[model samples]
Target chain A: MAKLSRRRFLTETSAAIATAPFISTSATRARAQESRKLGFAICGLGRLSESQIAPALARTRHCRLAGLVTGTPAKAEAYMAKYGVPAGSVYSYDTMHRMADDPGIDVVYVATPNALHAEHATRAAAAGKHVFCEKPLEVSVERCRQMIDACKDAGRLLGTAYRCQYDPHHLECIRLVREQVFGAPFIIEAGFGIDVGGPDQWRLKRDLAGGGALMDVGIYALQATRYLTGEEPVVVSALETKTDPAKFAEVDESMVWTTRFPGGVVAHCSTSYKAGGIQNMRVNAERGWFELDPAFFYNGNHGRRSDGQEIRFPEIDLFAAEMDDFAQCILEGRPSKVPGEEGLRDVRIMQAIYESARTGAAVPLA
Target chain B: MAKLSRRRFLTETSAAIATAPFISTSATRARAQESRKLGFAICGLGRLSESQIAPALARTRHCRLAGLVTGTPAKAEAYMAKYGVPAGSVYSYDTMHRMADDPGIDVVYVATPNALHAEHATRAAAAGKHVFCEKPLEVSVERCRQMIDACKDAGRLLGTAYRCQYDPHHLECIRLVREQVFGAPFIIEAGFGIDVGGPDQWRLKRDLAGGGALMDVGIYALQATRYLTGEEPVVVSALETKTDPAKFAEVDESMVWTTRFPGGVVAHCSTSYKAGGIQNMRVNAERGWFELDPAFFYNGNHGRRSDGQEIRFPEIDLFAAEMDDFAQCILEGRPSKVPGEEGLRDVRIMQAIYESARTGAAVPLA
Candidate 1:
């Protein structure tokens, strides 16, 4: 036919655009032929980056450390040299969005402190990139929701670094709960605690770390309680402790809390910064009790249970499986095992726990 | 002496008795170089007594099985034959009181159903013997208090069997919690559950066993939580379930409950009969966490950590220690390790749990 009227032409073009596929790097790229050579980038290279995350990333398979981002050029160069990172992939915080322009960078793992996660994640999403955010998902439920929204708006996926979810021992505990091996689970007992003495540590600052160990480690148990019981907490009651006025001036040193579910399941949990480093989770069911003696983070020794058999994970790296999971989520367009909403829910519970602790009453989660 | 008025003679006799030095049993009786041969009598030798108490006594020192009292004469005879008990010591319920006249029996172990414990223990006390009663001293707090009163009236000691309190794993867990190794505890998670195939057992009878698994097993965890925390619970909230109305006709099959203590520590606990066997407890403190993976009533396996060293109680005789403690309490005229009032408080808490479970509201213990 001849040239159409202006309105008809505009309507036809809009319809064509709506029907066509939208392109994103994760969706458009071919799967790397070398299954063991996947590429990934490090966002917010902080202490964890230097101590555990970067080192673990170097040792992981199905993925390799490919790029770095930091405001400090010297630190970036050092990180690149330590991990054999490529030169063109280095990015400043201001120019991190340009990382999307590099085809070699497949995923952006955000290991920054609590407050910076949203900004980095939003920028990465705007660049049409997948994101692996660290814990607390930007310090608040609202921020977590916004990050999720941003990822959805950019047609990308988001994953949170709750490394415990990838832990085999934790997985077995979850299985026992879900399969009713212990019978209808009636209670979950869990906690995370450490003697983090340094006053200058980022975790001691509410603005940078969100709250306390509750935000950092207790969330592991909270998320685990939900995953294990397969029930959402309906009400929460809690208590807070801050022994040293000056050292833990900004955040709580310890927190004890309880969550009640509709199906009569209760989770009793606690987190502390003024205590010795120990992590554990136990579920009591109708049939029998199943437990992981020591849970959460440990390096020298670890244990898991599979089909009633206790399996030890000696000298295992938690960061490897966590990093691999993030890459797979990016490559497959699949949802993360611990998704953005899981992080949001955890933050919501954390907020409720604080509110309850402050008010000396039980706070209901609506 | 000159004939005196009846009232004066009675008063003089009382004065003479009171003025006389308190008799040391050793002075009136012959002393043996070996340890005193303590003899114990078990009443209502059913499941717990047969499976745990009797076998445990066999493995013990400082005590030996001297007699058995059963409602069924056949059971009494059978048990005596199997345990190599003396022929003069077997008695039925009706004759149990007279069996206390037997000189060989120094203590009575009340392992009867909940409802019978009060009567059996009271009679044992009246016969001038020490009493070791199984958990939930009586069906009700009023009855438990009565048992305490009777034992005191008779000048005899009353001890409730809280086996886990003597277990090495649990003892270490308690030490860490009380020492604040995990920090000032803010939350407690305690639970006990077992899958009992609806065997029409006495425990399912409201009149005989008092309540459900809560009265039988959950009380152990509740007592453990309180003993470990050394704090009284001020408020209680609970939910109860019985999926199979026929099986759990007069009792609850499952329960989820909570307790709030003075320092804002909250214990969220559960108990169930339709689940597999599980025994676990956790304390979350301001500084750290203390937990027992295989917490209560384990046959052999147990583990804990204290003072930076892992303590694994591969195998130990908990019952022997429990019996020995009772014996020492009696022989030394010291208070029981877990005295009658402690049992009374646990019963009070249990009653509150049931009431809260029924009312769907928080019941204040205070």
Candidate 2:
């Protein structure tokens, strides 16, 4: 998968958010509107929201960019004008729930940094809005479960932006491994790391990004491990390394961890911001192997079987698929490919990696 | 690249031993005129030696079958007859050095259990014979270094069979990363793991296999990180895991390790014989990513740029290249591509992994 460039990422995320649907008390009309065209209101219009999410929404066919929610009035007005959003579509974070009163907006896509996800998503769920948020789910597992529970209580859907699960190459890998072409896979190795500039970035802030690249990109690998193996990790061990205490004052620069399942399979993963850019995953079995690379990025991918044949999949827009799937779920009243529990499980594992990294030992997740 | 069957491995090993020149002195013009073929004398015809090594040798062209070294006289006699070896070529471990007295042999390939490599190779080196040994080099880094120095002093070459380094796909990945195609990589993820059979195997005996799969297959990933990046890891942190104490009596069943180089490049590697098999290596750099799949296995491989174009290379026999390189090093008086010091460095790092795994914190390597 190609790494979504900052500009493209924002554009894609925006597009996805704009087309997503909101929850309605009346199922019949809501489902009709949802199937026709889902409208999304984005909660944050910062770099990620403006550059990727908005553009993604604008480019989406199943959804439309309905509204903007920003504390900054100027940004809200400017973003609405740039995307041709109507004047009634603008709302501040304090008044975001009022969007429920507007028929234009169907879903609330929270694209803020890690810490804001829980509050924004929970409030969106309360207002009877469908929720789609970026990764880490929440800074804590408890908070993530809370989001899930709130969404359940409100009868609104909850989904995470685990794009890799929708990625064609990754899906193919999962398919092959599931088929046992490799013969009882015993190990899964996954990792993602990048040189994410200075401490000025929101990711460097523990309060904002939760944990580092592991939260940002590494979680994809962890999620991939689970999806590929179809097993839950029962135990975990980890090691964390940081070069400069000042640079990595709160979050880690890099980490290596292992997750053990009830079966003999172990998933090993590594993540680093200190390293330039890295993303990859490998699955090895008795008879053969399956792998994906540039595993974690948003671009094209390379994959093959242990028998030396390329695994080909008809290319589809991953972001589009994710958006369409969510829309379809809402239209059909079904569950999502990456539902709340999937998000909860990944967050749980991410937290375990942090715990293991902190204690510098094997942490049993039991 | 074919996985060598025991018969082929031993036949080639014996061939490499039998048809060769002396370590200290070349054969006379008349003797050299007979044939410039490589011959091997294998000391232990155990399963691994028989299955992988012998089959690999039979497939090799640079060497021809020469002799067998076994404690079982009947077995040795049977193998010689089966492979069409002459009667005088068979010898037991105690009489292996005396094979140097024969003009037909040139190298002594040590496929014995781990703890015996030092004594066996030391004797072979002292006997003025080139030595080909399996990994772990020896039980200790000090012993590994001693093996290196002894071979140097005796004017005999020492080569460790790090087969992955000879793989075309792996070499291409290393080349791309080192050339900065990925642009000064920051994080490296690599690992080897497989489900081991009954716990009573020699690998469970610390004195025999030296360590578990970390010393066996995991070392491939370690050497891979070093060769691919062309950097020495400066500091280390790691964690080890085992399922049952009784079953994991001698060595650990699983490990997760990290090596931090001076420039903030961290190589994270995990190894396990008790886990599912998942072997792979990935280098994440600023510009892009490069990865290898089925990393250590002979056949399965896929290498590519982050954009997913298959990085192409001329197909060549990896084992043949390894054997041929050793032959050239011996013929042209060049150093081995995978030399003793490289073996020693990995062992040093392995020791640090064990330390960190034990102490539950980062351990620095000097």
Candidate 3:
């Protein structure tokens, strides 16, 4: 085993720097299209939209922040003034459908609460815009299906905001597992959690957040396991724990779920709002293992392998990369790697997990 | 978040170096007893006994390899010749009871197959020798209970070779969790696995090993979870997967189980014979989190805290520390910290996990 410094490894791997062909193609397309940027209208001017997505749009190669849709006029005014957007480009949630008449908005990025994802995404698709919805795609599998159907019927693309799909370190992990670099992965452990703040938050409400930690953070674990194993889990068993009942009266504070994938791959995953910080994914294969701690973060993700190899992909704006990938898919007239169907698969598994937890029995997935 | 070098941290923590009083007492007792070492007769001449326990006994200050019991005459001769033991000190498994007449052997350490643990430990105890049995205690709870009762009737101490209990890094983790240094632990993820070889091996034989990975490596995760949370799980749910049915016809190739403990703590654990290497324990408490990766190894175990503190305890001979701890307890007339009951608790939990796996339902532990 040889020790490789993180700096050397990152430089050698070229981190998230796009390949030559991709850069050349993007430049050629820009020259042909007069450097036209894909105009994005961000729905829901909340913390993530204001702090992460808006800034990420500025950093993206082919995407531009062109419009805003918010229930709060004050937020709309602030965003418009900050981004130098015209008054005509701002619309309230109720008036968002009118954007079908506007050519400035090519994509509607839905960054709303969980329950509103389906509604927002469907409306955006009907308004003749491609839909880029944040994760959990929607509250239920049924809503996810509806969102997907709406986008298909309206001839628009639906891309889920699974940012890790564009992250370089995660991409390397996926490639390694797919290539069987260590041998077939037999077990996967992935989890994500955060110390959530107050009971009054939308995430604590069952109607708003759909579930709890499983809905918010556990999705990352589910996605990681599915991607790592390259198989759908056949069965799922889950357990729920709530230490502070009053604080989590309507939703679970923590959840632990086990899934048995097709090839004897078993995943033990967990998420919690009451517990301290954790974000990691470990895959144990027949010959060796590899893992990423802080796997799903925007930056500072590091990975190592059993063979003393380090995975040190350079840091990139995860949100920027995600938006750019979606833009590239649109420009290429191709489906997204993280498509509506990919989001649907996760929601279906999550539904089974909830069912298993509720019944206290293993639930078979379709 | 101060970064302390491993050397500095180990020096500050003193690793497993016992305080002055303990060292002085051991020295004084050795002098008083004319330097007579307490003798340990290992009951099996298999891989672990030959490779780890015998060498560890040589390193222990208070214990010495005094006798050997093996069904194989060749193994007995080899061990006797290697250790320079008298022929009278070696006994076949059938003649092991005759050791009752020998005064040299003070403790009998059972490192036999799981199914033979109870019979060997009971026979050793009936011979008026203290017993130190390797993990699981026995194949079943009934056998563990009988072994415990036999030791009690003979007025002999019964210890389980849970060496991690004496490992300084694990000890520090236990201390932190027990002392609530990071508030009450709400979630625990523990797993142990190795890529085991050959279907003909004793570990794959259900009759000899009792189970598959759960009987072997999985017990480590179960024990670690209990020790870290300081609580017994009330209910368990499990799922088993066997990808290579031909290779694992009699037992599971992999298993994932979840347990719910008192006070809303949930544990997610997994083990596999076909999986790549993984031995880790992570505890998520209300205030923060901490984890030990490669936790159960004899050496090179490292730990980290949520506060960015590294637990850099110096490497010690884990087997030597464990044997010495047991010898010290015997000399002091105190009970072993990892007593028969501690092993019984884990065995009970394991039984529940197996039942849950069999029925695909949550099984409650009484």
Candidate 4:
């Protein structure tokens, strides 16, 4: 992640040097050139922020932790103490509009819960900072569009953090398929399942988490299917099963769905909150098959071909890579590879899956 | 296959002796007691008959090859040369009715092309012999029912040769699932695919073969799902893809289907004629997972559980076991475990699968 960004940084730096002939104050120019890396404010310091994103900011070459946004003063104090953020840089979610006056933060990474992604993202955009949000962008398609439209109205870039899009193993698998190394991939079987916590967890609430396992981990499989084939599913048929009905009354416990893409490719995908160690993605092609056992993980992953060739690549910090890539997109004034539209696409597909499961029928996408 | 049969053979032989006091003529009783093994007439001298079933008959303890029914004199001569059979016992497809006069042949094994199974099975049943038909039963559900009805009308046992039902590896896997060794299995992923022959082969012809991969090989995956779960699918959604339209104009080259069972269990299945060695069956339960790699093969199969235990079983002639079981069922005046009803179930499912593929929608079964 750093290698390519550094090369681009040097090239852009030389370009900036060649155009530094304006007669402005030397001090102002010095401040302008102080840090080439983008500064990010983390919105919502929950488990993801505490475990992955905050640590990742320290490792990214093109980004740094510059601010914190939360309603809790204790979380703000701990984040400030550990990451060395100034007292003035920490603000509550209600006072986030004051960040428009602070030039330190160039982007806001929304690590809030699923339902709050739209609110945080739009608030960040209104504060004149670019927004980088987590997966399942929001619980509903309408909310996802609101986040996108807010950024568009505020003239700020909006990126959805699809972590696997930046992972080397995933990239390698996508490359092999796009290169026709395994022929045109016609069938893909991808699933992610992990036994979740007790019923009191926020993930068990339909209003908060959207739809349990399908929203949390299953979307990873859904996203992988889309990126792996570079195609959108035209139709989907799904089945939702629950081992415990009372525990999963508000959400799906297990879901299995099959879909057909526009170009003859079909996928069988599954997800669950009742089974563990069921994470894997397999692609069957014209020649043979290739798969990633434990395909989606924050720790590490392994991918290999049917003929026994490992999809070997260095395991860099995936969190750092995605953040830096989004930062790089902000720096270059370019739309991110996974923009808000991409996130909205997944939300729409997921809604269709839920609809199919609920209706006990196949759902067609327009 | 022989070990269990030997035990049963001994038990049945003792029972026969216990009832021998009512014998009227010693010559008639001696003839009845001469051979406990059922004599089989192989109805078609095809590749499966020549390679697996004929050789398997040599290994079975309760069955023997007593007749050859075929129009090809050369195949008959070669089979006769290898396995001893009298010239008078050899008959063509049209003259197979003459076998009613000979009591030596007790069962007719139908190993013809997919389309001819109904005619041969019904004829064999009318000839006063039990019918042991090969996989697929027939191309259409109507024809399959005809075979079943004809056998019922004649009071002759009709059994479908589902070899995997007798395969030790598959049986072991089924046993593990049934015993809840991996917890109650709620999801199964099963597929069988082989790069079939060119366009000249009967498998590519719509008339002789019902479908390409789905019939020739894919049915194994479909049947495995049924046996592993012991539940009939309630509905089926399917997709069929062909890499070469002209070559597969008459049949399906590749097919992927997803189905839901009555008890919330779902299956994702695929079959192909353009991809080789894509055969495997994996079942995911509440606790963990278990799988059979290369699950459907005439050669061998390996099944392993996720908790690091082996579902190990001794490799035996699956063909021999299925034949012996059918013969034993005849001797005991009972139905074979995999009787006409079981075969009809698979045929109905596959027909639903094909219908769903053709209509590009889900087909619900009654």
Candidate 5:
């Protein structure tokens, strides 16, 4: 690798994963990789790709928007025209494997529908590109494993795009809890809710999204508890509520879960499509407590502690932070702070939560 | 019943149980009851009795501290001298039945150790006087039932001293949620904790307090959820932590519970003896959320809503409110809002929580 200053390579993000970048992925092309910014081809022109990720890539310091993969021509044309990419850099999803011949794209960020993640990620790996997939990782553990194994077999890194894991506020919260700044946290209450009203959206179709609020928003709460506690839950129980049976016939409208970590940390998490404005996370520690309101928002997040301390961090573009970090990982030939395994852990736990909710019992993790 | 014009017979307590006061107790002493304040013999002389309850009694408009029942002569003499009660009005616990012939003591408020509550309450009932017991009711369900049966057998109205049930803040909170002022409530997060350091105290002894923070302070959180949601839990789960095993060998040092109520409401509650200064309650309603800081405090309780409405209510002397409400119940010939059955419900649910924590499963309520 080119001798980039540790200053340029290191950035203020999660103290919890500060040492992750030093891990040796041992990519033989490290020398070539270090000379230029990592190129990311966003593999789906969905709303997130059109709005947050693409706009964020425009401002990232270490990552460049290199190519587009989409089923629709207008979206591809618009993104290509907007980003100044060559027409040869664009490919339809069916022909994305041809990108193996192109050297412009070093990574593919998969932001497809839930059930389609495994296919896109595998294709990206098979095309000799690192894979960065959005959350839930996929709909099931088996699909996530397929993605993980495909990337490993292809000798390319696989990253899970956990944006909050890179958000400054959540990073600071992780620092506080991991360092025991207010003593050990014993209880975590976290959740996300949005009154998503699209009746025909994929998120409401069980086949497309896999679940309802628990899949779309509840995963945020589950991830918050895991990252903050730095421990996977040992036992989990859940209860679900569905106010409109007709509207949510193919999915769940709301869900609540109770989880117990090995160290005796307990968490209560909830997610809902019926009740909005519920993005918050509270950690009750030994000496005091700290909480974030509007916690999981894309912006304007803030927090405070019980001892009159403000939990503030510098402003950050979440998408840029995540992508830049992934770029650094690629350059260093290391795995990301949020890897495929982390996403797989959450997916398996969420499956247990659903089983518990259905059976009205607590499910213990092995 | 009293001809005391519903003005004196009615009160602003729990809106959830507002209709309880009109139920008839049929004491057959209404003509005698209407002429004077109800006389109460405080059956314990502990710190709570000396500091809060005694001073609160001095200010109660509908009740009088007419007697004292203590094994120690010094405590008996001190209370009698302070309250101006005659020597004959005082009785030792062993001989408390002797007061059955005396007209000065119409009710006995049992504030003994948790394990002794049933004994004292049953004794009071056998003396043909009404019984008002402190929170927890008893150390176990069987004991609580014994007290309830004793009162029923004696044809005496039995009240449980759930002080917050009469706290103005909690009552207003109940009114808001019960009235659906913020649509319908779906989630409740409540708890109380004080770092009581006495390792030799009855609370840590297990036998006296039955459980540690779960019984001592977690009950406050349970009662808050019950009153605020106006529903009993359908299933409950718990996790317990003991930071110092030796210090808490016989009792839990900290405990957390997740409960699902009928009507799709779920609650997360916690209590700790090792972590202090934790008192708050948040209710997630359909349209908005309301929360209280210093929620279960004896004073200075305040709350606010997500819409920026301050959750303020008139300041209240908690002891006076509960005792006066009991007095009104006796005078009106009806059960108090927090009846013995209410306390029994909590004790049994607490048992389920402990069982869940032990077995790592969710316990369903019958």
Candidate 6:
């Protein structure tokens, strides 16, 4: 019977609802027991870890930066000072296994380059810590399988940092296609291209980056096809073009590939280090279509449908959501939405794409 | 100095320049003799001919709709009445060759279905009239070559109705790529798809439509690649998916293809009959990129460069520009920009695409 201001009403109602279920003494005890946050020790001090993951930890409710691991002592010192990490909690790659004695660290987030993902993730699991590795889970399918098995054997949770899987616009696009809102999708066009300047970058190195644009950014295009169709591709045919072979001597400069799904859906995709930045995906169906330009960016992703509908969602911290989701999965004793198997699927497809490009033939996937 | 309005200034300046070049009386007479318009006889009273070609004739500076050919008597009656064409100017398809006796009809524009283009174009050429055939030229490479030979034997110019060639936006895009405005284009993504309704439509018949969406609309995607790169694809790999077999029993429902150019550039393209309308072309180069959505439409085509430059051109009647350009070629005793040879190149590429799709291997273009 009281007329309250909007802010006052919302605050009082939320407080009352929050404490309503804990009124019983047993419920209060259970709530307290389940509210602990996970401590994440990031394994790499690269741009992604320093600029994205560490800052994301500042915003995450269920995860916090508790420790640091780096091969460079300078990087370790810089990250520890920035995040207020205790000197006792810092470890080098050689001493990473010593984290087993540190109860403060719960999960090791492997933010290393593509080639070192499996090594870091496997060691983290062996140390009895949960593992969350950035995409692609590993450079090779076999290595991805090993990482998955190691986590399973250690009875630790494993998650791939496929942040787009938690993005609202991408989720809505997937939902539209899965529900056949536009009628069964028959064609998908997805591409991700970025101009990687300087030939001395790690991405151009065969040992460090694994492949070229496909490994670094083209995986986003590959992932878009799978999630849009919600099915595995049965066959892949690809072509590779290297205009500057001297500059791209170690890996492909650009690649174009076609993927055929089981339900008669075909995806035409491309990735290039030689091209200017472009990230977009389009799905055409029997009745209509939907698309997103800049689909896989950290933010500013918007979508449009054939029926004149625009898909807009509130922007959230992608890394924060991804990290918090993995921590919540560990707390709830559930498997990750983007599990190691999901990363393995993409690795197998990437391998097949490379094979098809090499042999100039269509490679059938198992 | 004269105080002249803008229009009067332009007109007086143009006329004074014209008279200065024709100071001699014979030169003035010769200039008048060279300015007569060409007569265009549309050879199919279908939707495109009725709505686009006939209306465009009203706007052309050097071409006029002087006659009509149709199998349906009612369509002929309707078009003649609508355009104020004399009854004597109408002829049935069986009697189209009699147009040789009518000197008023200078060219026959073949606007029939894909399979009927060869017959109509050849007959028009044999009737001592220049030919302007619609795209895909005739469906098959052999038919296209034969049409070219027929026009050549008759000593008449032949042009394929690739209206996009006359479109200013397309011309600007092509010019940018040809001049290496953004550096040599290394990747191209082009697609054309439309939701063709009903199984009973002529496009669903292999005999009438020649080969479904590729013959009807996919030719645009193929043309975009060639014009943008100014190079032919050396090898092509393709895949076909027919989701609705019952409705698409005689033709492909969807197709995705990859092409490799001589300069190590790759193109990924797709076309589908089951998709909602989508016509777009994007070219990515080493330095920058450019793209056009609705790239192959009759109008409403706009483009943008990666450097934030928007390619905005004044709207012009597509059919009018295409017809006038062909007429000017004939008047100047030269070849058309979109000659029969250009159409043959596309037909060969389309054949390779279909072959690769059937064989599941890359087919080299000869």
Candidate 6 structure quality by residue, lDDT tens digits, A117-233: 889988898887889999988889989999999999888888988999999999999999888898888888898888888887788999988998888888999999998888999
The per-candidate count of clashes, in order, stands at 16, 59, 1, 0, 2, 0
Distance from true location, Cα of A232 in model 6, Å: 0.6
Taking all chains together, the TM-score of candidate 3 against the true structure is 0.88
Interface RMSD of each: 4.1, 4.7, 1.7, 1.5, 1.9, 1.3
Q: Write the per-residue lDDT of candidate 6 for residues B99-188, one digit (tens) a residue.
A: 877666778999888889889888988888889988888888889999999988887888988998889999999999889898888889
Alpha carbon deviation, residue B113, candidate 1 (Å): 0.9
Sort by DockQ, best first: what order?
4, 6, 3, 5, 1, 2
Question: What is model 3's native contact fraction?
Answer: 0.76
- The per-model DockQ list reads 0.25, 0.19, 0.48, 0.54, 0.39, 0.53
State how far residue B14 of model 1 sits from its true place (Å): 22
- Error of model 6, residue A305, in angstroms: 1.6
- How would you encode candidate 3's per-residue C-alpha lDDT over A1-366 as one tens digit per residue? 122243233222321221223324555654523445677899998889988999999898877787898888889888777776667879888998998776667789999999999999988988888899999898888999999999999888899999988888998999999999988877788988887887779999999889888888899999999988888988899988876889989887889899888777888998888865778898888788899988877789889999999999778999999998898777666679999999989888988888988887789885
Q: Write the per-residue lDDT of candidate 4 for residues B87-183, one digit (tens) a residue.
A: 8789999998998876668789999898999999989988877899988889988999999999999888899988888888888888887898878
For candidate 6 chain B, the 10 contiguous residues with the lowest summed lDDT are B14-23
Superposition error at A132 for model 1 (Å)? 2.7
When candidate 4 is compared with the true two-chain complex, its DockQ is 0.54
Please tell me which model should have the higher lDDT, number 3 or number 6. 6
Worst 10 residues of 4 chain B by lDDT: B15-24
Highest-DockQ candidate: 4
**Residue A219 in model 2: lDDT:** 85
Writing each residue's lDDT as its tens digit, candidate 5 over A187-258 gives 788989988786988888888888888888889999999999888898888888766778899888878888
Write model 2 residue lDDT over B1-366, tens digit each, in one string.
132254345444444544444332444423432345566677788876666666666666665556777778776665675555567878888887786675556677777887888888887887677888777788788889788888888778999877778888887787787677757766677777777778667888988887887887788888888887687887676656565568878887777676767666767787877654456677776566767766677666676667777855665556556766675567555688888777788888888878866765667665
Please tell me the interface RMSD, in Å, for model 4.
1.5
lDDT string for model 1 (B148-233, tens) is: 99888877788999878788777777778767766666667777777765566798899998988899888878987798878898
Candidate 1 structure quality by residue, lDDT tens digits, A169-285? 776677777677745766667777777767877888888887877887777778878888777898887766665658878887777777778776777776777765446676766
DockQ of 1: 0.25
